[model samples]
Target: MAGCDVKNNPTYLLVVAGAISDGAGRWLMHRRPLAKAHGGLWEFPGGKVEVFEKPTEALVRELYEELDIEIDPAAVEPVSFAQHDAVDDEPGIVILLYRVGEFAGTPRAVEGEGIGWFTVAEIDGLERPPLDVELAAKLGRLFPE
Candidate 1:
């Protein structure tokens, strides 16, 4: 119901929660555990939504469940979005990126293998999943230079 987001195409809404702590602006990312698909891939702290939940609601729940933070709700905003259609013999995914500068509590890996804060420059240095690699670029456009 917002922008040109397609409701189809194996679509996924990737919510990104970012902030600055310790005088450094770092984006929060988490690694998937071994039991899931794309396991071990570093992702922007979120998961898929059930049919009954809104994207924003899903984000708030995910943050509390996965990161132990309380989102302001009023501060979360969409920054950029991308559709990933892999070439050749691979699966395609669409990700909707988001941004926020504020939240409650410290960020820890509450639901996965690891959690870390990465500067925008360091984000590109990590070993990321296929379409997830574009997250930084999308976020850049969202927050601007």
Candidate 2:
């Protein structure tokens, strides 16, 4: 991983979660593990998308895999998109954010970490993933309550 640059490119799946529950507009967010980069900071739960997978399709899989919740792809609405500058020698990613206005099941950190739900306004208060915060700002514009 030395001498390799990962920026302004695609090597990760940038995802945003509108963790709505029972019709409320809160979102699900998590704290990155200490061993990971940006550790201890809050971030919406999601990760890199595999090649040849649609964003919606990939999101469903990721949510299930990482968060242990099943997401209906059709329930996902594209609210915004963003491209992030890479950090820590990591590849830049195209983060596509969608509003999951309707979904089924509860969200839990199936992977390994702390997780929670916050209202749109509360997002900025949390120390969030640098890239995810960008998407959250865009989401604010599309969903003004």
lDDT top scorer: 2
Clashes of 2: 1
Worst 10-residue lDDT window for candidate 1 reads 14-23
Clash statistics: count for each candidate: 0, 1
lDDT of 1 by residue, 32-135 (tens): 88698788878787666656677777778878888888886577777655566655644455566657677789978888898888876777788777656776
In TM-score terms, which candidate is top? 2
Q: For candidate 2, list the clashing residue pairs, or say none.
A: 13-48
Q: What is the C-alpha lDDT of each candidate?
A: 0.68, 0.70
Off by over 4 Å in 1: 1-23, 85-92, 141-145
Q: What is candidate 2's lDDT per residue for 1-145, written digit by digit as tens?
A: 6664545344554554443433566777877777887888887666666666777887788788767777789877777777876668585667777766665677777765788877779887988776778877876676654
* Candidate 2 residue 71 C-alpha distance from true site, Å: 1.3
Q: What's the TM-score of every candidate structure?
A: 0.76, 0.78
TM-score of 1: 0.76
